[model samples]
Target: MTNNMTLGQRFLANEWSALAVAILVGLVVLASMSPAFLTEFNLYVMLRSFCVVLIVAFAQMLTLAVGHMNLSVGALGGLVAIAVGGMMEKWGFPVPVAVLAGLAIGAAGGLINGLLTVRTGINGFIITLATASAFTGINLGITESIPFYNLPAGFVAFGTGRLYALPYLLLPPVLIALALAFFLARTVPGRQLLAVGGNPHAAELSGIPRDRVIVMAHTLSGLLAGAAAILAVAQLGSAQPSIGVDWLLMSFAAPIIGGAALTGGHISVAATALAVVLIVIIQNGMVLAKVDPYWVQFLLGALILAAVGLNRLRAVRAGGA
Candidate 1:
């Protein structure tokens, strides 16, 4: 009965309900496939692991809401994580200082994307794809093929500690994402940002300062990615340069597969969270079922194809009807 409701109404009622259903179903299937999957320990492991991806996905989803994509997110995230670790190891900087450094790097990364998109008049794909290369190069430059380790004590607390049976580290990403969602949904600037992304020309005509929104949106994405980098470092206890590379694909996959569109104008933070969890479950199930990582990639590709096909068909049918 709920599934039959209009999407608009459903979105208003529970943006993440569909994703929650998917995750639950995935969990059940995985549990049935393997008896060991139901333990609280496994739950903790999965949640902890999924946090970084969820953080990145939320950042990506922000750009998607306004008709942009940040291909450099993974690289930037990795770079920041590495930076945090490097600072702690070499300079003995406090966790807060290192974390701030990471955030600064992220914000700058986002600002670059924004400037390029607006100034060059290039499509998002071209701008971000090029920026991704640069970000990767920056990573190589900073780490120089060696990873840094042994971050400060405070950094370790958020990632490895548990709070009331939940990962204490879950606090950062969850809070950041929720704050971002509220901003996008309830704030005036956020609305303008959405409007600009949804229909830039129209927004410009209506005096929305579309260019400013582009910069601001990209900056927000960058900040979130930076925060995610800190979380990654805290959780892993080291700043691995390659930590966020896999996230490039996973981050976008979460929201788009969950229900967000590529063409912009739609944003659902809650739904995006559920979407990311579902992805984590799929990976978890594959691991529990002893499936190869290669097969998981193929499965993800197949699901994405199916989702795109279904959506395109729905759009066509709606137009005709």
Candidate 2:
């Protein structure tokens, strides 16, 4: 395999490659460091742990694929969580109905973001960053600084219950990531998406709908975030104003480390899924290792920077260095 492949292209180009090895290595390290780490009970938690991150990772990957970044993903996710909780609790909506409302809020928010970015020509970073504050404030206001609690059983089952020993909600993110991978690599829209990302000028000249594409991207981002929020409520059995704060940071990091270009263009959804697993593994191992609590973010940041640098170096070489 080494003889047939360049270093940077190795993982992204092949499914059974370095990233697989990394996952295995991470598992081995975790198992060795903590005897309890590999049990079914803990594995369920690990899968659940990665679920939210995987959702946001896909959301960020989509935005970045279209040459943009959505800083509001975490905030928006929280907003949806609060919306679902408040709707069910205060507004007297049924659990399923409240969930639908949550999805509606997320989709509507994304539409506004997409329209604003497409129409106004503002930088996406600035737009989503502003939205983030707004979302956070709205979340705080909706909850009245108090957390929503004691979610119904139907909601909790999503995160806590299992089918044949697998967490129900956990399976969906994996399925989503796989479906996204197939879409991007094997579909017409997928290729068009890459063309739009790789060179918008050329894609526009070739008749691709640039504005529509971006809007769709943001819309999907919102959907994914909303779904994740619903799951968050399921897992926590409640909602909090700060529910999405930590995830906002980790979501962006996962895709970048998973082989997404920072400015958007090329990426692998399957790779992103693997990246989420790696992150979960790291976090789990950290807890088992009992290392300094503050070191986790530092470690993830450093890993992301390293991965991006490696990808860039490969791109440069492959482009004829």
Go through the candidates in order and give the clash count of each: 1, 0
Where model 1 places Cα greater than 4 Å from the true spot, the runs are 1-18, 317-321
lDDT accuracy of residue 83 in candidate 1? 78
TM-score of each: 0.91, 0.92
> Could you report the Cα RMSD, in angstroms, for every candidate shown?
3.1, 2.5
The per-model lDDT (C-alpha) reads: 0.81, 0.82
Best by TM-score: 2
Q: Which residue pairs overlap in candidate 1's backbone?
A: 66-197
lDDT of 1 at 161: 84
Q: Relative to the unseen true structure, what is the C-alpha lDDT of residue 39 in candidate 1, on a scale of 0 to 100?
A: 80
Q: Write the per-residue lDDT of candidate 2 for residues 1-321, one digit (tens) a residue.
A: 456666666555554355678889988877877888988878877888888789888888888898888999988999999889888877778987898889888888887788889999999999999988998899888677788886776777667887554688787787887788888889888777888888899999999999888888888888888878887888888887777888866887888777777667877787788888888888888887888878888989888887777677767655653
Give per-residue lDDT, candidate 1, residue 133: 84
